[model samples]
Target: MENWEAGWDDGEVGESSFDYSNHTKSQFLDDVERRLKLFMVRCVKVCRTLPGSYDGQHFGQQLIRSSSSAAANFRAVRRGRSQKEYFAKLSVTIEELDESLFWLETLVSTDLMPEHRLADLIDEGYQLLKILSKSRKTASD
Candidate 1:
């Protein structure tokens, strides 16, 4: 099992375990960045388990591309040149994550992979999406 998958089993990434109440902005962002990176790695690992068929290859490639892009853009957000740059990068990161979620859903909807196998990753994707969206909204305000 991947680290993120293990995370779910261990209750490390569960909703109750995701507390950031006592964290400073920098600490929260840093933690998010680490999670994003791990998410990318987990996606790649999942893709590797996909069948080598046409649909599998297609969705897997798209999944890897979007998840990796999301991670990279989020990293850029951390080093953003200004507020405008930060918002722009964050927007791209959100967009990429949305795409990643789509690909993941497609994989399961088309019966490429079992839904149960991907439930944790899909949950994590949505969780990350929510976290980033709230962060962007908070920053904008």
Candidate 2:
């Protein structure tokens, strides 16, 4: 038997999976935007799996909005007309991402979903949040 127990999931994305050092600034921005889109897609997939209960519906709706809004605001950030606008859009993106993370944790805390199932998604959200937070700080300095 092929040791399924020891195998890693192909779909898994970890923090070290990406090496951004080799990418140019433009490419790095593109990759971040793409990652945000993928994050929204993943959030949608998880939301679809939620049971048709009040808590599930409530939190899932919140998650979908925050995740998608994060991605959209990030797109706006890329096209920002000025430094102030870019910073403002970036701030919104970070807020939405933070909200998404809150919803994900809520799902687990409310017993609507297990921690293992949302672990990867939650981790990715944190990574993105940290990146944006740092970017915002650097911009303000």
Best by TM-score: 2
Q: Between which residue pairs do clashes occur in model 1?
A: none
Total backbone collisions for each predicted model = 0, 0
lDDT tens per residue, model 1, 11-96:
33456347765566677778888989998999999999999999899999999999999999999988988878888998899999
RMSD of each: 6.9, 9.6
Candidate 2: pairs in clash: none
Candidate 2 lDDT tens digits, 89-134: 9899999999999999999999999999999889989777766776
Query: TM-score of predicted model 1?
Result: 0.87
Worst 10 residues of 1 by lDDT: 1-10
TM-scores for every candidate against the unseen true structure: 0.87, 0.87
Error of 2 at 118 (Å): 0.5
TM-score of 2: 0.87
lDDT assessment of candidate 2: 0.82
